[model samples]
Target: MSTWNRTGPVVVEVDGSAEYLRIVDYASAEALRCGAELVLVAPYSAHASVSPMMPGYSPKAPAERADDALRAAVAHVRHRDGYATELAAVAGEGSRVRVLAHAARKARMLVVGRSRSRGPQRLMHAHTNLTLASRAGCPVVVVPASWKPCLMDRKVAVGIDGTALSAEALEFAFGTAAGREGDLTVVHAGLPAEHAWNDEDPDHSWISRADHLLSETLAPWTGRFPNVRVTRFLSSRQPAAALVHESSEVGLVVVGSHTGALPVDPVARRSVAAMTCPVAIVPHHVTATDHERISAAPRRPARRAGRSDVLTP
Candidate 1:
């Protein structure tokens, strides 16, 4: 089998930026646990081509650039190898999206960096990471530019709502904790209610159910993974804000995805947006159409501090 196998290959888009180096450490650790390998598909795409915009442009420079990056990135990763990896660079046909899309095929997941949002420009052009996440055949993981988190060995944190889509997160958290030989913590954030049909104060009901679900709905999971820890938080604020706050002390944070759902709902959108830690998004289910819209969109670079996209930066 390829070094990057059917399991999590951790296809990371490497620009060879100092900021992205942490991915090697994170990937190596995870691969060791899952018996998977780490792979590097460094797509070489340059926006500064001086040639004409037409179809017959020369491919030499871009091809060579990719080759160089692949050699360098592979060397760096090998120096830290904890798992087998396929280190190769691809000259993205027209855009970076092409190569990343290809890499996403049969790979466990995609991890990319987030451009600090600048303003309207960012909104329109978008970031390559979001593009991949929105379009990849599998779930895309966005690691912040300066993100570095510990491995999942003990204590787990996952966000859950009352929906079936949210339930997928439990699998990742459980599997991760088990791989670590440690405990698991499952957290659900929402306003509470009484019976399935009963209506009560959302805040009061949410807190009540948060405790109840841990004891009831997740009872079987507790037994499945000994030393499991769970807490339910009532959230009335931004979903991401609540998750971020609760997960600050955790090694890894998992959030379920409803990316291809009818609306792509607000929760899933916030789950991936602006998160400063390594994140695993379990997309409930997705289709090719979703990937197309995600990859075809153009992306602008991270804007300067004064840009409109940043409110407080």
Candidate 2:
């Protein structure tokens, strides 16, 4: 049966790299937090087209090799953490990206391990991570290999663009922060205002506009999640750079994919290459209906554009 019919597990991709075991650890913790099952999938490519008369052919089957790897990964997880959550192992066929993307269709989230590589090697790895983040039905959390198990920072950072998609990112960020009892930082980056008056004091006027937009965007979520502490950050840097800088201090960074409208390659590449924390790429499609419903509600009074007041929730 297709795993898609069920909806209780957090799927993780495990491979040859020992770093993947760390991914299992993070995914397990996330599964525990969500009260869901953890599934470890090891995907192997089948080389059926290879000629049998090759000079250096091995007799062992590809499925057998894949099964062995999957079993070892499961054993490693059991040895390290003695994880208590319900777990399963599957030896899937096809590319790792394809298998994981298929599994994510019914999962709470798809977790994958990323390691630092250079040049074309880096691009290859990024292609897989990017594919998963952009195509997965659920959120994709790309955890860096260098991440260590430490005391939770209790902070979640999210990038906001004042778009409907950003609202989805905010919802995920708020839920994550609330669950972890963490503070949420909403970062918005944009160019200076076009008007000369506002341009002279962009920090005052431009920042105020960004703050108002963020507040208005988060107003409904603030009501829904009354306990989540939120702080607003305004920057003139590029979105990717701003979020990446914020990622350094935050436990987790959340971003919206905007139904694939927003380019995720830059963040995905940087996250794998150097991010200190796991990055959650939450696509906006899943929350589109909710956004529409919220939009149909009574509108709030439009806040004045040039107020120096900061937004607090």
Candidate 3:
């Protein structure tokens, strides 16, 4: 679990792309809802990207591009009644992942935009987001590039793996559902290969075990978020596929990612790429119990000032 204070600012990336305004809108609303400051950061490279054919043409410097992005983002936020939330914009000089991770080091959460790329591009994009989430030390909300406000935005879903790994994710899901004043759906997906079952028996032990796990994992959160209606779904499909299916019906999907020096898990990578709705990747520390539950071995351990500094103004 993240040790940073949840009351910190809500940091968001401002890339000045087609989807940037929408991302800013989402971040602004989250900051307003949480009563925290909304921070906009634009990361730029040191050098300019000049094309060979455009050698005679002078393209804007990276610093200038970053400033422009931040300016536009600030205007967009203010235009949407974001005056109530404290706002700050920073133009940082570095890689996107580095700057964003630094900016959100102590943030309540980091909000970023997901590209609409497919195939290898999609996988690479998802990998970058997951990398940022792992290093961010806070939850990372990856909003779909095509996302727009709708009635379904009120519904939220979370995937639990029937272990302590999902503990922090459950907390975030319940809180988000309560905040939206919507329903929460808990999905637990188990593959047949992972479980042993009798072909003749109609009642599989895995089903009962999954049910108990969901109930036990959700007990405290359910009591805390009484107003958020909860629904349980146990599926035999792949974990990532199950969450992606749920994403179509909900506004947000929350899933946990193990934090360590190892590579990002396939489940999180696939779900984030495939989900149609916004996905929140909550990073939690992998515990000994998690290893025992999954029969896995232990793993090794493992943003955002503008111009190398984080400016408030």
Best by TM-score: 3
Per-residue lDDT for 156-198 in model 3, tens only? Answer: 9988865566777878888899988999998887546456455
Encode model 1's per-residue lDDT on 12-71: one tens digit a residue.
Answer: 777666666766556655655566656666666565476577767665576676666666
Full candidate order by TM-score, most accurate first: 3, 2, 1
Clashes of 1: 7
Candidate 2 per-residue lDDT, tens place, 158-237, comes to 87766655655677788889878878988876545454137567666766666777778888878878899888887765
- Name model 1 segments beyond 4 Å from true: 1-8, 46-60, 82-94, 118-131, 149-155, 192-204, 214-216, 259-261, 286-313
Local error of candidate 1 at residue 145 (angstroms): 3.0
What lDDT is reached at residue 209 by model 2?
69
Task: Candidate 3: list runs displaced more than 4 Å.
Answer: 1-5, 191-204, 287-313
lDDT of 2 at 28: 80
Please report how far candidate 1 places residue 184 from its true position, in Å: 3.6
